[model samples]
Target: MKKYFYFLFFSLLPFGCKDTNGKKPIEITTNDSSSIYLNKAQNKNTKIADKLKYYKKSFTILKNQENDSITRSKLFELTKELYKNNFEREFLSSVNLLTKLATKSKDSFYLAQAYRSKGSFYKHQATKDSAFIYYTEAEKILKKIKHKEGLSLVLINKSLIQFDTGDYTGADRTLNNAYLISKKNNEIDNLYAISVMMGLTSLETKDFDKAIQYFNYGLEIVSKNNNIIGEFNKETCLNNIGLSYQRKAEQKKSVEDYKKSIEYFKSALKNKSIRTEDPELYNLLTDNLGYSYLKTENLDQALALFLESLKIREELNYPNQIVLSKVHLSEYYRQVNDTAKSKKYIFEALSLAKKEKAYRDYLNALKQASIIDVQNASTYSKEYIRLSDSIRNVEILSQEKFARIQLETDEIIKEKDILEDKNRSLLYTFIGVVFLLSMLFVVRAQRARTKELMFKQAQQRANEEIYNLLMAQQDVIDQSREIEKKKIARDLHDGILSRMFGARLNLDSINHLDDPESVKKRLEYLNELKEIEQDIREISHDLSREKQDLINNFVSITTNLFEEQTATHSAKLTYFMDSSIKWDLVKNNIKINVFRILQEGLQNINKYAKAKTISVNFRKENNELHISIEDDGIGFDVSKKSKGIGMQNMISRAIDCNGKLDINSSKENGTKITLNIPLE
Candidate 1:
């Protein structure tokens, strides 16, 4: 399985920080011992122990200082230096220091970068599980901030881990996602990394032509950088392309495809700059090209390349590459029919593969040994089968472990979303409850206010009724006093005074007359006295007599109200009262309330109905008093319940009179209010 590097693409986005300036962004004060030590520690020429001592001294001073932007930036500077120099333990400590400073400062960009750096360190240690965890954490932060370049690189690293676990499907999907994100931002470095990852996935799946296409695409982008990194990546692409063609050639048994593979491998080695810039790539190409030569029967060139690659690989002590080089050399000797030399190289390659745990290459070595050593061929073949099964089982277990990791990460994200949704729901519920409580409070307050207003209105109506009663009583008393005075004056003038006058005249003429005339005069005078006394008694009786009942009071009051309405409003009105009804027989309460209801109805007609003409009719029907007040005016809809106080007053008064009131009106038909009451 091939692993891809992605952290280099951090330069594409502002949020994706990288120390491309070769030093800290801030100036270091030379007055401080910490600054001087940090500067010396970052120097490439410093000894390893000296660098560690300086870094430790620098971090001691940094921990005492506040975690600010400048401090965190300096920590990042040191971390980048350690990471570049492959100082694993020092790099981890620097990453942790940066993380502490970034957390204290609440700097998400620096925190994510720290996480990515830590992941990169773990990847170097071949700790894929820890590397994937840190990369995922970094990705979570970068994605939220829309740091496309950084997220793309982290995703590529995760995909590479998937590739190592034989999760080609997961790797291809993640690689495509990384490719799209980088493509949107036009980030060339991230695109190249993802393209290479996709190419490796294709190569693993044996889609040789498709893998070559992806690697070729990566080569085009890397060729523009005229540096060691660009040259290294260029060789990687060319070597991977050659591998794809060589696999295709072996499958098809085509000499033509093999030549194509040789052409690409030779091109990768053509630039001598690559040999010195990236010695491992040069050595790898040399071995791979020699293997292709062995396939084509170019014995001289093949032998020379194989020997040179083996010497360099063994000197470097790279067991995996050394195993490959030795295996190729063994094959070369076998072709030349040097049986003893071939067995020697093949045995050494098998021993190294087992020690390095390079099982794929070990299987290859075992298969080669089984063919070369005929005496122990069965033993070699049996070992090959068992080792192949063990490797396959390991690959399956790795895939399961990585799949579980992916599932757990997805579950955490899902749980976070659910928690957010629940929080929102609780917020909305609280608001709804508060709103409902407020509405209830308002309704109670409104009800209290309405009840108070109604009580005051009832008191006012009671006072008005008392005042009307007093006025009517005063008018009756005034009319009685005037009648008494006129009657007294007429009795005195017509009878009492005239009789006294006759007595006085008689008394004066009887003075010279005899006793008989005197007696007659006295008698007459006495009679006159008796007549005056009788007249006084009659006058007293007349004064004590009850006043005449001239007309029904209910009719009089109703007529007076109707007259007042006509005079005040200056409108045509008609009022008819059935003379057959006994006003005296009706209870005063009924009369009073009916009168009030009629008064309210007429007032409503005057104030709102705007009727051209109105009629008030009172009739006795079925032992009930029927009163109808009609107004031919612009009317309101009868279907709608009226909220007007005037209408409510009329209805209430009618109910008080033990009557039913019906009001009908429409725009086309003017308003008519009818009241029916049991007269009994």
Candidate 2:
């Protein structure tokens, strides 16, 4: 039969050189469930050491395999067998291989499953931090893939590890997330795990109703599966459920579940030949059963179970468990009035716990030991307080070390993030510089075109200005000609024409006849002479009014110039003058030049001085008419800078008008120019 199975195993193996070609050797088949069953059929020993050795040897061979999905699946199947057999070292290797293969294959579902298995293994081994890391990694991956079943399994595993670490709130929080996902996907196994976690957390928090509900649900699942491990786990949940009830003062119900859990555990022990068992699990059930018996004052049965658990823990070489069993045994002896035995066990527990640095267990032992003799009780009480203080100080030191480590980790992460940000910023800056160079080239080309357009605009403006100046000069010449013509015509009509008409009247009087008709004709000729004199007066008045209108138009042009300068520039302009200026005394040419000078002064004030206040003053100062324009704004060095055409024109106009223009300006003060012209 061995030769036939060997043939089958070799047939399953891929044929290749058993070396660098990555071909799996034939030894892996011995690590599978079929081999275990074959060993059982042949009635072999199946010891833990032998099983562990076989799996480890098999892993060496499997790693050389080409590692396809089929090879990965075979490895995972072998992992399940090793895990069940509790081959810790080989089990971890198999888990790692599966995880690596799943990642390499890019199979998220398989990777998540491998992580869950590894985390659960760590949890069973009591390594909570490692368990939580793997569980969280699996959860994040499964969530992204929308693998609800895988996500629920990871969450339930995380919740269990949280419970073990005494984090009841965190355990319940994770259980709630798992419960929602399990319910959505109808995952019975994940739901069972969630219910068990909830029951345990509620029991820890002293919520008896919630604890019982969840425990009952978990027990129902175990009953359906009829799994020995599941049944063992259900007993633990039931025991906790009972403890919760006892804490709540529901003694009757508490006793019922405790008795039920004990009965189930005793049945589990009976079937031990067919099923693999953990020494720790057996010790837990014994301890809890002993506790239940002690609570009910069943001393004989409690003592028996406590001794059994103690012997098992001692045989397993678990120091903490041994200390715990000793402490409980001491309590049992003290209750039975066996003072010597009680003191002996209590001291043993204290010494063992203190040696192991198990401060909590030491404290519990001290509390129990204090109850013996009154004198000893007081001494033990003081010792307990001293130890408590020492333990607290040690915990504080541990916390500071943990905090320092965490801070260093955060700083490292921050530095990494800053480096990443600098890299991104450099990339953006490179892009921006490239864009700016392109834009600069575009702008340089555009600027050349703009310069050409500006040259054309300057030429066009010069031509326009020359044309406007000629038109203005023509207007002035035409007005002068019209004025002279009117004056000449008026002189003829008023002086020469009127005098000639009077002479004609005198001649008519000399040639008069001695009849009534001659007399009437002479009267009519005198009337015509009077009408001609009136016409001459009207023509003279018309010429004088026209000359006055020309002067007014010149004043109007200056007013408009001032308005335009004020509106268009930043300067606030103010023009104030007496409505009745002695304009008739000023010659037409002088009036025109005065108006031009004021217009230029207003323009100069706006351009040179960035003034907010500009004022044009036109008032009579004694016998002189004074016109001043001032700006309460920035003043510059006028003498240092050459004057522009506008400023030169203004000075020239003042000189022509016989106006003494005195300018006073400073940088700190503002510019004020005064024009003093004679008003005689």
Candidate 3:
């Protein structure tokens, strides 16, 4: 009987607690389902690993295959999948391969795809600037090719980066572009992401009702799609909706809204798809739910949920989330009249918040401490108010930054449109002139009259070209000045103002404390202020250095042109400028004309001289600026090409600068050009 009972127990163990192999059954609990979720996640990761292995093998094989459009497309798809799977190194390798193949084949489609993939990689790595750059490049190509879907995708990615960088208005504009393309192409996924980002921006600006509507729209899309990823997005929408409700509740102090927020959070948490795919979201929902519970005065449930949120954050080792959880826990203890526990948790939170520079949490802790400690309430409240004002100012500054970005983007778009229109008008005018000239030539073939007319036309064209060039140069100079001004403004706004604000807050806090630690903190802040002053001096020095560089702009331009000439042509170049020449004293028109002469001369050399060696010289002699260029090549006969357009232009440029030009060239002796301009 004893043996039979033991056998029965052992046999029933597989169905009861232990499996046949003696391992415990996978347990699912309402309080903690982390183990089961992790197991499922591990299984999914294993599958991803297997898929990555297959992809790697296939990628290697495809690399050896013929580099055709179809083959390249397959490779890009595989690389994108690698990116999605978080195979970062492998994705980069594949991107490099695609880039090389595309460049070698001159395939724009593959190149655009490669850029998009690179952007996705950077996006995954959270390098917003680089990701934005690559996405912009991809968008340029896609727009050129009129690839509607690809353009929409790239724009969406760019908008996401803009959102991350706090360019909320700019993000909205970018998303609008993507929205139009996606709507035209019926790209549901792209539209879904755009809606969510729009909602997030609205949420950030406290447009709760608008945010809720956007979230609901996104949720409706996911509901229609009904895939695993769609379900995950649905959960995200729900969570965001809950967040909006929670904000509304705080504003209105409505217990009903808080209860609604808790319900939504709980519903989002119950979605099994989110559990494995986004554990961080799970933690966030839990934390928000805890806050909602606290607002509703459900003390026991709030405490339990807060502890759970803290456990998840601790496991993830996310400092920000952990600090937030601690703050909530401290608030909970305070509400429950547990003074000792509240003080302990508040102090812990304060330390972490200060270390993280999370001023909001730090201020919250100070307020709580003031209430509990009583003796320091006035000091704590004063510091809290000061810090609050500083934070509000910073928020205003950030909003202004977003507005500035929006304005800049709008200006760029307007400028682009104006340029396009100008180009179109020029094209139409050119066509009309060509038609008129053809009729004139057909009707009147008198050679001398024709020659006179042609000369007058050429002179008119040259004057127009010169006027346009000067205008462009002036515009460039103005733009550089504007950029410098903006840089100085940013330094003041982001660096000096922020540091001074921090110092003021610290000073306010110092008056309340008499401890050695407080004195030490005050000294540290003073040192920081000194460092900030030094930084200001450094920035001023940088500005001065830039001004000096601008003063030598002539030399800089000449050097850049020479380097470009040497890089593009087979010729070796030697260039010299006399150190004694005061470039800053030269009039702008003189400098521009001299630069143009050099440009025309070098262009002529490249086209006609076939130069193997070139030399350029600039100097001042007898209160006159002297410039010369010489080339050792099979020089053209200057007598035959004396009336050439290039030579005429060079002479005209010199004349415009109140200078004289001399050209010496022969087939056997090579070529040399010289210009002399009076300094006065």
Candidate 4:
């Protein structure tokens, strides 16, 4: 025989703000003086009917005066608040008022809000299709405005419908969207609602661990808030956590989990907030606690709890809940071997379930009845199987429809996002195009001024060129003398110094020897001296050869200068010299001037450019030696900034080289200094 555990499935209700006058009410406390304050507050709340009548009269008076959108919207909002406790009649009236305000104002926000309120009203009436239609309409407008809070509420409402219709997959997807929006907006109430719904979804999917986590998180939120809805959610989460433990107990056959489930359920029932605010949840906790006791074979405690739950359900006249209670009682009687009482309770449960058309309840009742009704057990068993199959098929159909609607809704939202992105991109692109056009005009004007300045500077450059040539020749001469001195110093250190030391050692050794041995060692030392003299002669020949090989002109001077410049700074310098470029063929004056230009460019890069990398490329193209110096550095505006002395010197050197000097620079694009010289 299968044992059934009753679990509470709490539905999330929309929480509304209570409208009040701008005065703070007296605080209600546990003291005797506070009792009078609490009584006055109760009496004030009791006059809600009179307040509603006054609001209607005021609304009618306001409608005659201005008929303005703001005034009408305010009245609509006031009327909506007055109908919070009234479900069907007053809620319908609020929906009408909202619709009228939306039409008059022609505002999408008002229209969307109206649709949402209508959806809520329809949802409360259990007209799910109408509710879905209204929710979808509201969602369209809310998504258009990117109203996350309203969209989240709509999603939560739609998910509830999906959940009730047994579309767990669809409901889970919808709730996930709602949860993200609520979390992002920090909508605590919506977050509490979504979290609890997610727990229930987890429960349905048999994901007990996730269910427990979600329930605990929701309970934490409720504990901090301590409002009417918060208290309700707290009780709901408590009940859900107990249900989770019960399932875990059943799965693992754990006695400890059952005891824990009982503890949570009892705690939920004892909670003052839950006890005072939520009778339904209180009864659910009682029934769940009884099941937990039954799991541990505490029959007396189980029976007493079950009887209390049944009494509450009976008083409330909730047929489904009453059926659940009777079913549990039947199971309890069967456990204690009270065959007649078990049969009696099971029949009563079946009658109630059939009246309510709760097929699951009816099936459960029949299955239990069959256990005791031996002879007619097969008939009852067959009927239960038939009903279960029918219900399963209906649920499958509902899920398919729900999934299709969800897919369409998601696609619509995706398309809206795509459209928004495209619009934003187009706007940015338009702005960029306009900016580029303006920059083009500015660049053209700058180029014109740069060309005029370069033309005027050309004549002055010629005079500077002659003076630079004479100075460069002297520098080259000085560098050559320095190179020769270094070579002579190295030759002396390696050759003359080594021979002198060897000769001293030989003499010292001769002193330690006898007369004949000393004479022999002296002769050997003399031969070594002769060999050293020959080595010295060879060194002189090598020096002449090195002088012949050395081309201490433009290429050599430029390479040496580049090395020195890089050694002094952190910037990296790279130079490329084409093998085909014959440095000897190039005129000395031209080479010197080209080298000077390159030196000046490098100096500028080191001092002002703040460059990381600089490259110098020397290549012969069509009898022209092309020398280009480039740096990845912060460049100056060639048109705006006047040429400095260094730049003028570089231009003068290029003029003396009989080459064209082209300088390309921009603020962010770096600088390229190209000097094209004729080799022929």
By summed lDDT, the worst window of 10 consecutive residues in model 3 runs over 1-10
Better TM-score candidate (1, 2): 1
Predicted model with the maximum lDDT: 1
Estimated TM-score per prediction? Answer: 0.57, 0.44, 0.48, 0.58
Error of 1 at 472 (Å): 78
Of candidate 1, the 10-residue stretch with the lowest lDDT total is 543-552
lDDT of 4 by residue, 134-224 (tens): 8888778877777787788888888887777777788898899888888998878778877878887788888988989988998898888
Query: Which residue segments of model 1 deviate by more than 4 Å?
Result: 1-36, 100-107, 224-230, 421-680
lDDT of 2 at 98: 90
Evaluate model 4: give its lDDT.
Answer: 0.73
Candidate 2 lands at a TM-score of 0.44
Clashes of each: 0, 0, 0, 0
True-vs-predicted CA distance for residue 528, candidate 4, Å: 60
Q: List the residue pairs that clash in candidate 1.
A: none
Residue pairs with backbone overlap in model 3: none
On a 0 to 100 scale, what is the lDDT of residue 132 in model 3? Answer: 69
Model 4 — TM-score against the truth?
0.58
